[model samples]
Target: MPARIFKKSWLIKSIFFISAFIILVIGGTTYKKIEDLSQSSALLTQTYKVNVELEKIFSHLKDAETGQRGFIITNDPIYLDPYNVGRENINSSYAELKVLGKDNIALQNNLRELNILIDKRMEYFEKAFRFSSVGNYNDENFKENFYNGKKLMDTIRVKIKGMIDSENELLRKRQQTYESNLKVTPMFLYMVLLLSLVLMFITYSKIIRDLKKIKAANEQLEIFKESTKQSEIIGQQGNWIWDIEESAFTYSDNLYRLLGEEPQSFTPTLDNFLNFVHPEDVEKLQKDVDKMMINEDLPFIYYRIIQKNGTIRHFKACAKLHRNLDGKKQLLGITTDITNEIEHFKTLEERNLELERNNKELSAFNYVASHDLQEPLRKIQTFLSRLEDKESSKLSETGILYIDRIKNAATRMRLLIDDLLQFSRTNKSDKAFELVDINILLENAKQDLAELISEENAIITSNKLPTINVIPFQIQQLFSNLISNSLKYKSKDRIPEIRIVYSKIKASEEPQISNPKKPYYHKITFTDNGIGFDNEYAENIFVLFNRLHNKDEYSGTGIGLSICKKIVENHQGFIFGSGKPNAGATFTIYLPFI
Candidate 1:
């Protein structure tokens, strides 16, 4: 190769000059086309304006003539309204049309003749009116004047039509010229465009090959950009750069998104960012900024920012100072949104407060149950025992019945106290949780109530149960109380039947409870075939001292279900019951398997 175009520098310069020349030729062609279009547009607009004015003149004259004839017939002033309006508007319309046609001397003379004819028609109308007023309406002179007025009106109409026809013809010619100009002028532009494309192909043939290298560079940068954004979002962190010299801030995209905003919505300035901070926290943020400014060491700050949605979020930010070779100082920092962490801490705080309040109430209850309430019930039971053992024969039948009633009342009170103590005991027990075998627990419960189960002629059946973490004695007592309830509420016609069903389930599938972190549950349901009460009392049955039946119908301390509720709660579980009137009751308990 003697000489290559790429090696010759002058060839590159020559290509640029050729490209510039091609563009100039195309631009000149476009300009000529635009000039022709502008001239055609002006002519068309003038023609339309002239036509509109001529039509206005014709319409006004016809309206005035109608008013004049109406006045001649009815002689009413109201008929003059159309005539008055036409006379007022026609002069302005004619003046505008005449001025528009001033450039064309031939049309000027024609417009002058049209204006004179319009004036003569109105004069004839006025002359007829004067003649009719002076003489009779049907006089010869008045009839001659009205006839002349009609002839003048016909001449005015013909002249207006002539002007309108001429204007329309001009408009059509201008439109043809405009269309011809667009086609002819763009031909030169197209030729010039083809030449320019050829030159650009020579210029950028290697440039396109080089652009591949640049594109790969850009793709590498994009990988870093995407990775940075992903890391920020996952860690709930965002980076920011503050230019100390310029007092400006460059925020990463995730930083803006973290504030519930789109990137590039507004520039990140100190004051602008502070606007999203809570009012109560703004002072703290401002002071932290000052501290970062003063210290050479990187500063750490924690504060709250209110998001665009009006929700408060907590943030922890730390910044390091950086200096480029150009000696420009900036602060490169990362900020982490800790809203979820803050919310978790707040939840723990609330839970601790509630536990504290419960402890205080339990202590107060324990005090009263141990001391104040137990003394009266104990004395009554002691006196009843003394009368039964030592002086049983002296009392009459009614007295003995009264003593029995009092003794029965005392026994119920004592049982209520014991159950209340048991309910309160579930709150603060020292028993550690261990894996207890449920099959053995149910057996122990049945054995404890052997005499009652035999007397009530009841049948106890249970499916296979799971070994789960629980307080052993408490779970045993839970089964015993529920089984005893079924025995006590049994109908005379049907022998009592108690079914204990246990199964394992995912916590999400269990409708009675939800613990997403702990995914599985051990479900135990104690279903009884006894005298079930109304479903309305389903929730009410778990309340302390809540009873569905009277003592004569069913006897209990009324604290058994409340104790069951407490036991389930201590095990981090749920207890729910459903029943229908005179149907059966199902008591379902959900215990976490974790």
Candidate 2:
């Protein structure tokens, strides 16, 4: 609202009018004052000029009297020349005196008296000049005429002095008026100038105060803007900002942490932030950002991050873009960490898989127990029934013995079914992880089958073992089954040499062997020197009810390897066996560290 006020139509119009009024007042006042002063200065200048001319005329009158006296005494014609020159100057000066005296009766009367004296002196000079030309220039008569001329001239000189005094007095009075006007004009102008300055200062001070208020209002607006921006950022999980003109990027601390980074450690940039995104999701994110910036087309994105600790986390960034007043489409956005959410989703998926697997295994177990195992069991029972039905007269001892053997076969079938049930039920067990010492576990397993190992003369050797975090019972069962297999399938007269080797391996071996871009792994090997099965059955060994040999030849329920496979895989690992028909078998297990 304040921003709008500065741009108001009335405010701008008022400023323009006020500024024009001030300029007009100052300009008009200054012009009028200058005009009046110019008129006064012109009058003073004219008065000074007239006064100077009057002083020159009086000086000529005095010179003319002196020249006439000098000519009468020296009898020099050169002196007459000056008198003639002065006489000629008299008429022109008289005209000037008349003009200067236009409004002054006193000065006009003095000029008339001055003209009378000049006419009397001219009459006397003319008579003297005629006597001199007619040779009547006798000293006695000439002296008398000179004396008469002196007396008349003295009287006229007194009048000229009086006129000169009057003109000097007028000049002095005019000068005094000019000096007085000059002295008072500056003081009056200074007062007016000082008043104008004070008025202008007040006006400008008001303008500056208004400007300061506007500045303060603008500062408050900025503060409000920052507070609003901060609220928006904190409410969202993470936020991003783009300066369109600057072509730069800015992100909140949450965004950096979402990408598993420290804000202070790196500058936020589109390229830098996107680099942390999983490669599979990079193209989509880049395209979305580009479209938002270029065409104002916003898009939502969910991507994964491989954290600094090598943990996988998921994130979703969402926003919409519109042009600001400046026409820049800033990409304002929020990002949220979805690692726990993704984990929960994965757990649900895994749970579903386990349930489905349990259902399938149960179905297979029921089918196999009824069809495969029961069929043999039913035949054995039928044979024994037939034996009992036909044994009328004292049954032959051999017939009873053969019937007992058939019953034994039926009993073994039932035992196999029971063993399979036990194996399938392991999936349903909620076993928690505990520290499992492989060396101690293997020794106990060997002790359980000590009699068989001693009778077969099998040598079960183990390298130094590790205490791993695992389901202890599962690990024990795993090693026991493996050892049992080695002893059971040993070549006759060739003692079994079982070797279990465990090493602390770096998580880098055969990592890319599965998928080059996948994370690394750690491997543990269990190798045995015994009669190995065919390579074709290597994968099948871990299948329920799958056997490499007939039931009559090997003593197993065919669930041992399957149980071992399940245990290793539940820990996010892989179990695979490699063997030649007669050489030996080696099972290598791989598990991720994180």
Candidate 3:
């Protein structure tokens, strides 16, 4: 109603100002200022996005140059593939920039000059490439061609940087202007609103008493009741009034609709209302009513009702109690259908319970399997050691080979059992959450691998770990598995260099590497300079029994990463791994903060 009144008043003002042309100047100024503000905001946002895209484009150009250099030095065409692809993308990107800067002639001219320079640079570089392609790899002009291209690229970068800075300055000025207009706009609008409110009050005062004298009391009551009934029906709500002293009641027809019953069946009595409630909710309903009788204000409640068809329906009831003329309390208010909302909540709850149950069952199975298998595995290892130590000379070469294979199989099985059991325990273990110092955790894991570290002459370093809410043992296992995997996958030639770091990050943006569920988390990263695998296999690496190398080449069950993933997930956190082949790997764990 207020919005409609405002619109009507604005329309009238617009017409009157058009006829007189006196207020037109002020209104035009206001409208123009608002338009400028909106346009400036939009332009500022566009410029920011353009600047980001420009930076990305620049990075791609650099990558293309790097690829070209790599291919030239090694005479490998594969390395040049990305360069050709990047060159194709760069042309389209520059075309987009031209469109973006069409409104700014100065920026467009700058870009045109940069493009000309790039053409000159590419022309010389192409000649050098042709020389190399024809087996004239010792072309004396190659160094000069590379230097010319680098200088041209540098000039292009400087021109783009200047345009970005100039646009940012323009955006800053627009923002300042926007802020000034915003401040003045509200002040002028408030003044207009104040004058309008005064005029309205004067009009109301002149006619209110006269109007009241003409309206009949019972007619007003009827109008009020009719409006209330219409509102309840339209809103899918039911209104009721309980007269405690008279032991009588009244309800809108909407109330019967809410109960899934006909109006004729509703008796407007206390027991009639109670009969509609579910048997399980009757006591709660009575208690709420009794509380209203005593306190005149019973807080809102939700309860279920059994419809005529025996279907249970949920309702949200809210009531206010007021004293009648006789000083007795009367309760009046509404019951709204909330069946859909309740059912949705129940469905979500059931899904959660189902997931929890599945996790528990998985964990229990792992524990049982590990315990049962350990006895046989221990016996096999013991027998293999005795056979190797006491009767190695008596065994034939084939027999010796069989014994070694058996030992390797037994070792692999033991590791698998251990990994599976650890994964299962994450689901069943008591979640005793506490602030864990991650720095200590990483140091502990490093210490556990001290023998391997010394043998590889590994370099290990870490930033201070944050204290976060987590299950300590699970955190330990998470760190240990990741670190061990790094060492186990190291290049046989190079010394391993590992680094652990931690930082705080928003929960939603948390790395989907592990799938964490909280709103804020500590991100711990384990980086290693080892022989990394293909990035395409990042997901497969986390699955149970997944292996990038043959078992004989890289020993152990492939369940390490899977267990680490499970532990992180159970703690409502995420873990992810990224790396280039032979460029090393980074394993990140995001554990939610308490």
* Best candidate according to TM-score: 3
lDDT per residue (tens digit) for residues 373-427 in model 3 = 8988999999999999999999999999999999988887887787767666665
Worst 10 residues of 2 by lDDT: 511-520
Runs off by more than 4 Å, candidate 2: 1-399, 506-508, 511-522
Instruction: Put down candidate 1 lDDT per residue, 1-594, tens digits, no spaces.
Output: 112323454666788888998898788878878988898888888888888888888898888988888888888768889998999889888789778988978678888898789788888878877865664787887888888888887787787787778778778888888888867877777888988998999878745654565577678778988998899999989899988888788999889988989986897888899999989989988888888878743577888898889978888899888995457998899999998998999999999999989988978979799778999778878989999888889999998999999998888888878888887777626788889887898999999999999988889889999888889888988999899988888777788899999898888876667544468878888888888878888899999889888877788878999888888888888888988656678999888878
Q: CA lDDT, every prediction?
A: 0.84, 0.71, 0.77
Q: Roughly what TM-score does model 1 have, to 2 decimal places?
A: 0.47
Relative to the unseen true structure, what is the C-alpha lDDT of residue 400 in candidate 1, on a scale of 0 to 100?
91
Candidate 1 segments exceeding 4 Å error: 1-316, 320-331, 334-355, 390-399, 428-431, 505-520, 580-583
- Model 3, CA-based lDDT: 0.77
**Span of 10 residues, lowest total lDDT, candidate 3:** 1-10
- Candidate 1 has its poorest 10 consecutive residues by lDDT at 1-10
Per-residue alpha-carbon lDDT of model 2 for 70-154, expressed as tens digits?
7756778788877778777776777876876687788778777767777877777777776765656676776687677778777
Q: What clash count does candidate 3 reach?
A: 3
TM-score of each: 0.47, 0.44, 0.55
lDDT (C-alpha) at residue 346 in model 1: 95
